[model samples]
Target chain A: MRLELGKIFIKDVQFSDETRVENGILYINKEELLKEVSGDERLRSIDVELAKPGEEVRIIPVKDVIEPRVKVEGKGGIFPGFISKVDTVGSGRTHVLKGAAVVTTGKIVGFQEGIIDMTGEGAKYTPFSKTNNIVLVCEPVDNLPQHEHEEAVRMVGFKAACYLGRAGKNVEPDEIKVYETLPLLEQVNMYPHLPKVVYVYMLQSQGLLHDTYVYGVDAKKIIPTFIYPTEVFDGAIVSGNCVSACDKNPTYVHMNNPIIEDLYERHGKDINFIGCIITNENVYLADKERSSNYTAKLVEFLGADAAIISEEGFGNPDADLVMNCNKIEEKGIKTVLVTDEYAGRDGASQSLADSTPKGDAVVTAGNANELILLPPMKKIIGHVEAADIIAGGFAGSLREDGSIEAEIQVITGATSEVGFGYLSAKGF
Target chain B: MKLKPVILTNNPLTKSSLENKYSVLYKKEASLLDILMFARDYVHKGHRLLTHPLMGSIKPNQTPFKSVAVSKECFNDVDLLSLEIIEESILKAEQLIKSKKTPVYTDKVLEDFSLIDFDLIKNALN
Candidate 1:
């Protein structure tokens, strides 16, 4: 598989009479974008706002953040199976609005939705704080179910992303990055001297609010499977899970998995970089055992000498992580686990609910339970009262002056388990 | 159901502590029967213990032990009991034995012992 990622660097996003990309600026006609996303009758009102880097704006109860990318010359379009027809993507050419993002915010679906601050102390934690964000605030009709509201907001984000992606259809790319991976046998033959490695990618599939989709199929029903490294880049997997705000792999992180990118950088050099085996973090004990067993079996069958397993969400999923690590290492395969901590507010409790001695090589993505104070932004994009009930928040989370005093878990991507963010924890 | 001894303890135990003890006993090449004997002695000393089928013995402090144990029995018809279940069942039995709300487990509670997941004993019998 081969992919040529064309980067269209977007420096600023502003509302204009016409929606187009000009000289690194993305112009959006708010009315047109609103109409495109407000097709669902469930939504009472749709408002589009531009939030650029260094802006004094805060987007709370954020559902998902997506990068605008068009499949310029690919087998399938961006967001395959959701907005686009399901075709085998991850090959050929694709153009990305590199510095621009579509941030979905609306009535809080679950207490787990996140907060993205464009600037100020809160900006330092989230990667979306840097992107030129096109904020979509969709208010649902009264008395709508939580699941329906989430689905409406999630679909709108994808729709808006696809719409913005069209602006780069004709624009020439600033730079193109080429990534290729040969078939399993050919790849092995090419890098026989290097140690063969596989990535055990765990998806949060604890159903209801916590779900992930692969080619429009619910991930919870799918057993352990293998996918080409580039498939994710083409939007093969998307997050619908509303886990804790800090660690859940949002759609943006799914599209740009740092582990895959970093593994590719070391591919053919330090390691063989075999393809990825994706498994689920199911709530059922049988499913956990079966998925971990299948994942380890597949890694062993792939002839991988080592593997890096990345987890999504904390708590019950920690059991899945340890199971994967222990089973893989039992096959004489070296394993490295990537996960974040939930060691309470003081970072003193156990980081994970589960533990195994086999998880020796582990990378912590920092503690989600650490407390932080977010000063009031000049403009609030979504419902401000939601801060009081959101997952990492207490009764007094939303202060009288509009400031927020809560755990870092309320902030989006503060403790990304995929090594997406820079925050990390160390024992004092 | 065959008579299977369940150790009920006053204090909850962490999985790490249980795992550490298991590792030590495992390094000494303790057999399943030997581990059960040790658990019996531990229970006699008033410490909680639960033996699982696949997960070995878990302390049950952190996990959803009560739900896992109940579901295992309801679905599999097995006696894969944990320490938490034994404690709860014993408490309930003691309440019956004393004919009061508060549990006062005398030797009467032991006489009326019933395992949670009967499958463990059934499989052993088979």
Candidate 2:
């Protein structure tokens, strides 16, 4: 499969009377984009705001962040399963609104929604702070259940992104990068001398705000399966998890999975990038055992000499990580595991819930439990009071002065397990 | 409910050592709640246990002991309590104990207590 990613570098974003991209600036027609997302009756009100890099703006209780992309020459549209029809994508040209993002925030969907600070010390920790964000603050109808609210906001974000993506349809791309991976047998045959490598991508699917969708199917229902490395670029997977904000792979991360990109960078040169084996992190022990067993079998079946395993969220999924590592290594396949830590507030607690001697090559994505104070921003986009109840936040998290004292877990993509951000942890 | 005598140890000893020193003394079947209640009483009697900065010493009165003084390496085969299970058990036990009734520790609760979810219960032993 081959994917041509045409990047249109967005220097800035602003609301104007018409929605269009010109001179590297994205001008969004607020009323038009609002019309696209307002179709959902679940939302009581929807407002769009612009938050640029280096601004003193804070988007709280952010549900998801997505980069706007439009399928130009693809077999299917972007976001194959959810926003677009359930079609096999990832073999064509797609245009990206590079450096711009759609940030969905509103009333708290669950205790796991995150905060994206545009500037200050907090900005350094989150990748979203660098993007020119089109912040969607959508409030659901009164007394809506958290699950329903999460679903509503999640879909709205996609709609807004898709709507904004249309702005890049006819515009010429600033740069075009092509990525391809042949069939497993062909790939191995072409790069016979190179070591065959596979990527074991774990999705959080523990149910109720901890779920990921593959072609719009709930991930928990699916077993381990193989996908082309390029398919992820076309949005083969979407995150539904509201887990700890720091580690959860939001939609943007899913679209631009760093492990896949990095591995592709060295493909055929250092290693034969076979493909990706996607699996779920189900809560049940039997499911965990089955998924890990199938993942190992798949990697072995692919004749992979080595593999990289990445996890989403933490805690319960740690078992899955260890199992994947141990099982794959038991089959003589060298594995490198990527994950974040919850080493308590002081960074002195055990990093993971599970461990095995076989997990020798591991990449830590920083400690999510480390405490940090986010100074008050000049303007707040969403509800600031959510800081008191969100996961990784305590009762006194939001002080009267508007500053927040909370763990890094409250910040979006602060410790992305996929190596999306530069933050990482080390042994003292 | 007749309570069994429980021992609280603060030594940097393995689970086997703690068991060898105290398990025999409290051999009678007792739920974790019973042991925690005893620990609270022991602390009330002016005993102090070493505590870690992140994970403080376990206080009997505080159900779902946030931080315990034992080191992570010392938790081998001890059925150490995780925060999730401890919190759940404490909520149930408090209701029962408040009514002056013996809390029935079900197999599910016991299993949760025995199997620690390390991710959810990090720094359990500082």
Candidate 3:
């Protein structure tokens, strides 16, 4: 009988008739050990040799006893859903979820000792604070009111609004200011107003690489920022759960990825949220059908849990109506429309009512100002500790099935200050 | 060139800044030199900050010059990584330069590089 130990084998053990006393303890015979070792069938390859008494008692096995093991060889698999990676080492090696390769080098901490020593430094520098909570969100040009736009500029330290120029046209700073100054959002009467805080998006003139770049703003008076390139893995751009860019203004800056849960953790239940005004309308571009497809893809890409849209009768009525309905349905996001019901003798909403697939759509009535105040939103009634409020644009032109999408933007402002608002899309 | 080094403790001296934000033992502004001075005064009159029986202090001059040099060694690799970080950090610095051109500070345009921990690099290599 032979005994296997990992890759090693032992055999040729002496068999003692009985146990003997050695150094005040009883020592078992090698023959009994060999019998126990060969009991398993997996050890059949091992051949144990037993030695007689006075013959240097020893046990030996004939075969190597290496155990079989399994391991994944390469990066050949895909993760099914949103997974996050974090680096433990101070080096750039980051740990990916459901995978082995490090995602980044900056997040990792290198040595345990070094970490202990430097951990005090981070605390000394005031790494965390509560005064810098802020969130910035952008809206279309025509949606925001004039007064509110000026307020936005003063509050967030910049003007914000949609770009109303032709794609490819040079966007001057003055021209950008025009859209940025649209007073779009009405401050809700439920919270204390932080004079210098607002959330808005921006349309940078990237020349020809892409049309417009979008991002979530997390603080006020923060120098302009950029994200850690969100990966475009499988045709769709993957926005990481985090955002970067905090070196702008040292005094009033915040850093953290704008994932929903992170907002909850920092603010807990004491969140001050403002209402989101979505601009609702459907139009076209150089290629109407192609543009529609791109819009649909963007909706899916944003992946908001739910949204509210307003579609207006702006361009090609039939195509725009159908386009809105088709786009939102494709994204599979829950939607509610706050537009007027088209009044016909037959009680139908619009000419394309039959053509537009019916599901869950709301139709409104009255003048534009009346429509603005129509359908008082009950969701934003109580959670109004909002320091920032983001509004949307025209939404009546949508067909019965068309829907718009939006997100709840919350920022870890420059300290512990937080800005909460909603990001929405409508006019094209 | 000889390197100048400073050692800080969790303690704060009289009217230290850390006292405003955090609770601390001893003097917050107390440096290695201050600690030495306090020890000398204590030896003259039998007063001491540390009297735990098992604790002791080694003067800077009493320490072997080689040991003083040893402490400097701790920064060599860190300095190297800092250089690499500075080199790699150029792209972000350029971005900041570009962003500064705009009058308004946009959250979307700033780079949160402070979130990057450089200590991680040395720890990994070690």
Which stretches of model 1 miss by more than 4 angstroms? A425-428, B1-69, B72-126
For each candidate in the order shown, give its overall lDDT on alpha carbons. Answer: 0.73, 0.74, 0.20
TM agreement with the true structure for every prediction = 0.80, 0.79, 0.19
Q: Write the per-residue lDDT of candidate 3 for residues A1-428, one digit (tens) a residue.
A: 01111111111112256433222222234354334223222111222221221221111100000111111111211111211122110111111111000010011111000000001211111222111111122121343432233222222211000000011122111111000111113322222342211111111110111011122221111222212111111001111111111101111111122222232232213432221211111111112234345444544443333333332221122233344446656667544433322122232223222124533553332211111111112121111211111111112311233211111011111111111112122342
TM-score-best of 2 and 3: 2
Local accuracy of candidate 1 as per-residue lDDT tens digits, A172-238? 9999998888899999999889999899999987655567899898887889999998889988999
Docking class of 1: incorrect
What is the clash count for each candidate, in the order shown?
Answer: 7, 1, 101
RMSD of each: 11.6, 11.0, 33.0
Name the better of 2 and 3 by lDDT: 2
lDDT of 2 by residue, B1-126 (tens): 112223333222223234543331232344335544444443334332222111110112111212122222222233222332223324433532342232223343222222222211221121
Which DockQ-derived CAPRI band holds candidate 3?
incorrect
Name the TM-score of candidate 1. 0.80
Q: Tell me the deviation in Å of residue B83 in model 1.
A: 7.3
- What is the Å distance of residue A166 in model 2 from its true position? 1.3
lDDT of 2 by residue, A106-216 (tens): 764333359999999889999999999999988888877666888998898888888999999999999999999998788899989999999999998766567789989
Better of 1 and 3 by DockQ: 1
